[model samples]
Target: MPMPKTIGHQIHFAKTLSGLIRRGWWEIPEIMASSCMAAIGIVLGIVGVYNYEKRNGDNKEYKSVYMIMRPDDPRVCLLNNPVYTQYKRF
Candidate 1:
């Protein structure tokens, strides 16, 4: 025999509520919230990688040709190295 419509609805509601209470059915809202957080984290991670690349892309070499001197030197030694001169204005 077919169940009454109202009774069917009530049974379905009870099943859904029971599932929720038992942590059986993770519904759309929970899935959406988790996915949204993962997406935000991915975007932030990409932004961080892009910023890191942008900050360090130009200068790959750490070698320097200038000699260090005391600040009390009467005449400041201007670094005349071509690489140093070209990058000084940057």
Candidate 2:
């Protein structure tokens, strides 16, 4: 008889965990990359949440969403300048 899906998954997970515990899993590139990517993703998610809160707080006008692209900005000026647009170097 076949094992139930949940039970099978649990058994597989336990086996994998046990194997990792026995033989330091950090030496494995796959595990290192997975852990690094997960950590980066979590940090980025936190920064995103902080940005959202700051952008949409009670003082919305004080921190306008377009604050990054102020008209006086050099980058914005370059974008608007016809000469810059005509010969845009990749």
lDDT tens digits, residue span 1-90, model 1: 997565332323345666664443344667767777999999999999899777655343344654566767743433244345444455
What TM-score does candidate 1 get on C-alpha atoms? Answer: 0.37
lDDT of each: 0.58, 0.58
Per-residue accuracy of model 2 over 1-90 as CA lDDT, tens digit each: 997566332322245766765444534767767877999999999999898877654333233354456767765643343334354375
Instruction: Count backbone overlaps in model 1.
Output: 0
Scored by TM-score, the top model is 1
What ranges in model 2 sit over 4 Å off?
1-26, 57-90
